[model samples]
Target: MAQAAAHTDTQQHPIRLYLVVWGWLFILSACSYLVDYFGLAGYPRWSLILLFMMLKAGLIVAVFMHMAWERLALTYAILVPPLVLMVFVGIMVLEANYTLFSRLAFFVAGS
Candidate 1:
């Protein structure tokens, strides 16, 4: 009696929500495939791929993982660290490119 009532009090999402998410996931996947099938090259190709990947990942995390129902602080805790790490990685890549270019320039000039 009490247990049944308590269980019913828990958050319950409709099946339609999951179905819609699944459909979106399928569509996003097809778009991702099309990016490669069309033979897009350079920044545009990689940009589309990454954008689709992030959108799919975001959808999975928010809906499938039940993060959408979680508190804001919890969502931030789970999401922020990875975003910060990605920023740091981008910085490192820029630094590495600059160092490589500088070294090449010095070598060529010296010779």
Candidate 2:
């Protein structure tokens, strides 16, 4: 059985790239704050928040976590589960709403 060798590549990434990513993270964070400060209401606000959150998470995972240089199998292994989880979460939300509505309709409030 052949054992997998680790750390074979000695290629060092540029410091400037990390610094730039850091800057973008800071900027996105500020935007997230501004969204709250401006008091954005309803779905649009949550949509923007989720967008920035995902973007920052992706950036951090891709660069600082070194996932971008990782193997394809490893990359998909790490990323795909969360996508499945997100789908489940959406289904759960819909079920929760339906459950609440059914309960409200089926049972009367005590007077």
Candidate 3:
């Protein structure tokens, strides 16, 4: 049917966009590795690493997954889970510092 053909065309547009996005993602990853291997970054090493990772993730989500076109509720569903895990990571880091410092203080007091 003509409607089915039109529907197929609409689907193809996003697929094409996704393919292009993936191509750029591959290029970015390759370039990031080259930069890292060449030791071109003058600042903190993790800064470049995290920047590339975030950029790659953003492109993957925005173009490949089409999260940029999604509704707010759907976007929140995708984004919130990782944010919860990040909060848990932060809490764990704080707890680790607290425990380590407490043990050190106890050792000092006992001595």
Q: Can you write out model 3's per-residue Cα lDDT over 12-46, one digit (the tens) per residue? A: 45577768888888887986797778877567566
- The segments of candidate 3 whose C-alpha lies over 4 angstroms from its true place after superposition are 1-23, 40-43, 108-111
Supply candidate 3's per-residue lDDT for 5: 88
Candidate 1 lDDT over 10-69, as tens digits, reads 777999999999999999999999999999999999999999999999999999999998
Best TM-score among the predictions, by candidate number: 1
Candidate 1 segments whose C-alpha is farther than 4 A from its true place: none
Candidate closest to the true structure, highest lDDT = 1
Model 1 score (lDDT): 0.97
Could you list the CA RMSD of all candidates, in the order they appear? 1.5, 4.6, 3.4
lDDT of each: 0.97, 0.93, 0.84
Distance (Å) between predicted and true CA of 63, model 2?
0.3
> Model 3, residue 51: what's the lDDT?
81
lDDT, ranked from best to worst: 1, 2, 3
Error of 1 at 111 (Å): 3.4
Candidate 2 vs 3: which has more lDDT: 2
